[model samples]
Target: MTAITLIQGDITQQSVDAIVNAANSSLLGGGGVDGAIHRRGGPAILAECRDLRASRYGRGLPTGQAVATTAGNLDARWVIHTVGPRFTREENRSELLASCYRESLRIADELGARTVAFPAVSAGIYGWPMEDAARIAVETVRESVRETESAIEEVRFVLFDEQAYEAFARHVR
Candidate 1:
């Protein structure tokens, strides 16, 4: 079983193999975790994002899917970018939310990333309920590991605040 850890801190600071970004579909860097990663990771990350946009992901990355780029100045070796679904009360989109975790792990496995640090996807400006987001993130990562037999040995949920940290902790424990 993959070890799951909850850290109440910035995701960029973790010295892991990969850091998962809660990216917008454009992958051009927006607010929250996406902007922070792009700002700290430097031009190399944007350059690769440009290359991805020009080549395979011309129309922007689809929601619930994940792609990777160089970590640049960050501590990690790679950044797994995944667009999460915005919270919607009118429809049930928890599967898409769960897919964010699953796909990131799949990409992490492909990159041989043994340790990955992740922020609460869609729980920031996208307005996902913190508790539900935490539950989905934790449960999906656990389920994916059980099903795929991935190379990832550790999945760290690096939350920005105590509330978010405690929320994820509930599920992890």
Candidate 2:
């Protein structure tokens, strides 16, 4: 069985096989987790992202889609980048949000990663309500494990603060 764990700390510091970044469409680097990963992971990650942009992801990574790059200085061996959709009342984007986790895990399985770390996708500046984000994240990951033949054994949600931790904790149970 896949174990789902929640930790209130930095995703970059976790010694997992891969860390999921709630990245923007550019995948070049932006604020929040994107900026933090780029800053701490050093230039190699960015360089790979640049190469991705120039070749495969020229128009930018689509929302709900995921891709991987070198982890650079981060403890993890790989960084799985996924862009979450912006929240809107007119559109039902829960599936898109779910795809972030599913796609990341798919990539992780391909990389032979047994452990993965993630943030609450789109719950930050993307304006997704914390509770809803947590619900979607937890439910999707759990469902993915049940539905797929993945190599991942441990899935960790690394919340940056106590409030985020508590939000994810409520849904985890």
Candidate 3:
């Protein structure tokens, strides 16, 4: 297995095997990381996302599910998109976000991807707390990396800013 690297960088700039999209259930792309991904990945990403929108499961996604598409203009060969919930009063919000990492990893493995990069899921418009989100994101990815039954060599978290970078970096140990 390849060693996972925690890098302070841009998800859009990283040349990993696959980049995880912090998307809504619609998958059509919205603001924050989603908007950046959509813009950098170009129109083809939207076209393919539009093609799959109607088939989106209830709650934007069934838990622990993910979809794949051409990376469009993004550096990676493909993008593994997963929807994480907005902070809500409902149950299982933590588990749902954790599933975003898990399901995306599962999809990456299926595609024979060795390296994957992720943004800080739900930390933008979704309003999940940075410190808590950082802890969960790191733990989830680390645990998933361990439990995956496929040939996933590396998992990375790419941060867009110093604050986010420091927050995620706190989990490196």
Candidate 4:
């Protein structure tokens, strides 16, 4: 069974097997959720990212690249960092953003993690409309949960704004 929840607060605060960061291709740091994660996850996260960025994957995030790092102050033990393209961008935002959720679960499964939390990707600096983003997010996670090998127990959409929270709540049940 797939259980999805909507919570209001910092996405960094959620305690789960893993939490996703709405990062940029660089993986160093960017606006919105990316910046918050970098700020709270501490220097180690970024330091590791710098090296990962240089791989064949390079520092520039490929669509499905979801990397893991130790959680510094957050309740989670690990952080699954994925770069999600902005919906407002002219590029194929849907597929890339969907990759963020699906690949995150894939990474979690590889790590044997059962629970994960995600924020509203691309809704901040990326400007994905709340209604559409919530639908895409819920659908992507629901679909990913069904397809992945990971024993995913729960997926959360943690919203920092009330409107976004309510929009997700409306779609999740």
User: Which stretch of 10 consecutive residues in model 2 shows the poorest summed lDDT?
Assistant: 143-152
Give the clash count for each candidate.
Answer: 0, 0, 0, 3
TM-scores, one per candidate: 0.98, 0.98, 0.89, 0.91
lDDT of 4 by residue, 1-173 (tens): 76788899989788887888887888888777888888988888887787777774563877556888776677787888887665654555787777778888898888878778899987887778888888888898888888764487788788999999998988887
lDDT of 3 by residue, 1-173 (tens): 54556777779898888999988777788888888899999999888887776565433555446898889999898888887767765655898888888889889988989889989888888888788788888888878877765587778888878888888878866
Look at candidate 4 and give me any clashing residue pairs: 53-58, 53-59, 55-58
Residue 121 in model 1: lDDT: 97
For model 2, what is the error of residue 156's alpha carbon versus the real structure, in angstroms, after optimal superposition?
Answer: 0.2
Candidate 2's error at 101, in angstroms?
0.6
Candidates 1 and 4: which is better by TM-score? 1
Q: How far is candidate 2 from the true structure (C-alpha RMSD, Å)?
A: 0.7
lDDT of each: 0.95, 0.94, 0.82, 0.81
Clashing pairs in 2: none
How far is 122's C-alpha from truth in model 1 (Å)? Answer: 0.3
Better of 2 and 3 by lDDT: 2
For candidate 1, the TM-score is 0.98
- lDDT by residue (1-173, candidate 1, tens digit) is 69999899888899999999999999999999999999999999999999999999999999999999999999999999999999989988899999999999999999999999999999999999999999999989999999998878899999999999999999999
TM-score, ranked from best to worst: 1, 2, 4, 3
